[model samples]
Target: MSAEFLAELATLTDPAGILTGAATDGYLLDQRRRFAGRALAVARPRDTAEVAAMLALCHRHRVAVVPQGGNTSLCGGATPDSSGQALLLSLERFHGIDDIDADNNTITVAAGATLASVQAAARSAGRLFPADWAAAASCQIGGALATNAGGINVLRYGNMRNLVLGLEVVLADGTIWNGLRGLRKDNTGYDLKQLFVGSEGTLGIITRAVLRLYPAPTAHATALVPVAGPQAALELLHELQAAAGDRITSFELISAPCMALLAQHFPALPQPFAPIPDWLVLIELADAGEDSALQDKLAEVLFAQGLDEALLAQHASQSRAFWELRESIPEAQRLEGVSIKHDISVPLSAIPDFIEQCGRALLAAYPTAQIIAFGHLGDGNLHYNIFLPDHSAGVYAEEEHINAIIYREVAERRGSFSAEHGIGQLKRGLMQHYRSPVELALMRQIKQALDPHNLMNPGKFLPD
Candidate 1:
């Protein structure tokens, strides 16, 4: 059956695009190595026409197809199932920047282009593409849009959904929907592009996108300040935003546990202070004007508020160093040990309360657990992760309990269980447990409407 499907796929794709054996290994596994999927073949398409033809063939053969990008999905969204019955579709060859309209502040980019490439293109045109994450170098623009990713700059510029003006999608039946209108205001009808933006390829494949750009920041000021706790950190966030106005581009919350993991694993990295503070907020301010005076304004606000213990970056290297420390937390944690991770968001006002309550609850339930909490506090999203220092026997068994305790608190405060990460294979069960019946039914209805045969990334996002 697989051979027959591959023979048909070869007719639409080039010889270089087909991968039969070991070549499909990279696309078969996820970034975290949590899920090892199997694929009959990896079909790399050069353009939208090839992709459409390939999908049409797959649909005709009734063979499942998985849309893969960089395979950097934390939730196993791009990885195929273990059945070896699916074809992994790769978009690497469709690499091109179709257009860069500097006058309109928009760029037309292919889905295979990396986020870093997009950022560099925007910079080359004297503009900025604000959507960024740690995996920008390897993650593709298509996956980012599919996941609706949010990163450091989400506080100022919005997520992938907000930055995207239009998209070119290949629907389930291999029909092309070219809605790549770069206009800012178009109230024609239902925003069709949005349906596939965060759809995770369950509905269709994103072939190209029209991304919005911003004026590049000419000045940058970054600072690392110590705080007493989450409450104090929230207070500092408010103060800095009030003083710096829209210049406050990033406000990251780093917990003491995260600092310890960094110190223990990555000793060579520069420490923010001699003894790490219990809590720290890594703040960054960017401005289009060269003489924004961001550093002076930050100093004034911190000193006036009696939060004087701070480290300010006077140069570009120092600013990078500060960001380096913040960015290295994930790697440090991975080196430290296994952890139960979560991406959650709450009301800006309820962040402090949520942290305190969730921490108290988790500690009471598992005494040896350490909360390695950190994330973009300015956007009210936290990577609330848990690690057991003692490595108890039942730690892994309590994964469900840990998730329930945290998600229950999130529900009480009207927060999201999956913040920036999309509900891929990892969180599909959680979606079934948390989402209201009506919401779940609506999603299934849409999925059936778009891909009634379920040949497009069958076992992801929506549950059976």
Candidate 2:
């Protein structure tokens, strides 16, 4: 069966498209290297037609299809299972920026187009594609939309779901749904494009997208301010938002431990804080006018709020330097070693309480655990990670107990266990625990309706 499938797959695309044996090795491992799996072959479809045909063949063969984008899924959503019976559908070859409508403020791009490429294209067209993060250079548009990614700009521009105008998806049985309308207002029944967004490719494969763009902001202001604590940070955020309004672009919370990690790993990077405060907030503001005016407005707000020690960026280089520290955190943590990572979000008001309580609970359980809590404070999402003394895979042995303590706090405060990251294999079990039975049933029904054979990225997003 495998031989026949590979033969037909080889004919669908070029010989270079179908990968097997060692060639498929790279696609099997996830970004975190936490989940490793096997695939019968990695199929790189060049266009929507080829993707549909490949998926149609898989449907006919009753083979599971694991759709993958830039392979930057931190939750192992793209990696296949150990069965070696699934076909890994790679969208790498479908990368293309089809069109950029300056008037409409929309960009039509192929699924495999990287976030960085889209941003550059938008910039060239005098527009802005605001969906951005650390993996912008490599994470593809399809995966970003699939996961409904939220980045630094989410506070102002919204998540990937909000930015998407329409999508082109290839269903399980060769059905192509082209709803790619660049309309801002559509009073249509059932916004179907949304179902696939953040569905983690369980329903279908995203082929192309019509994404919303914004006017390019000429003015920019960035500042790294030291706060007394989470409460102080929250107060400052409110004060800045009140003064700057929608112009405030990013407000990231950085912990002292993160600062220490940066100093240890990235010693060459500028360390602004003398003793490193207990907490720091990296704030950025942008507008259409001049940078001096925006910088003055930001500086005035910080001064009014009594934060005199704010390290405000004076130039483009300084702004880049400030952003570099915030972006290099994940890599620094990786270099530090293995840890139990959680991407959780609560209400903006509950952040301080959540951090304080969760930290206390975690410490009580694991006395030696080092809490690395930092993320988008403006949106209440924190990449709260725990580095045990072991600093190895063995620390994962306590993941269940640690997760129970943290997730319980999150639940109590009406927060989410999974914030920006989608529930791949890693957090699928938590769904049954966190989500209500009715919600899970509805998801199952949708999956059943879309892919009755369970061939579209099986054992992901939804539990059996």
Worst 10 residues of 2 by lDDT: 455-464
Q: In model 1, which runs have C-alpha deviations exceeding 4 angstroms?
A: 390-395
- Tell me the tens digit of each residue's lDDT in model 1 across 296-391: 888888888787788888888988888888899989877876787899999889999999999999989988888989999999999998888754
Per-candidate TM-score against the hidden true structure: 0.98, 0.99
* lDDT per residue (tens digit) for residues 1-464 in model 2: 99999898899998889999999999999999999999999999999999999989998999999999999998999999999999999999999999999999999999999999999999999999998899999999999999999999998989999999999999999899999999988997899999999999999999999999999999999999999999999999999888989999899999999999999999999999889999999999999999999999999999998899998999999999999999999999999999999999999999999999999999998999999999999988999999999788899999999999999999999999999999999999899889999999998999989999999998888877
- Name the best candidate (by lDDT): 2
Regions of model 2 farther than 4 Å from truth: none
TM-score of predicted structure 1 = 0.98
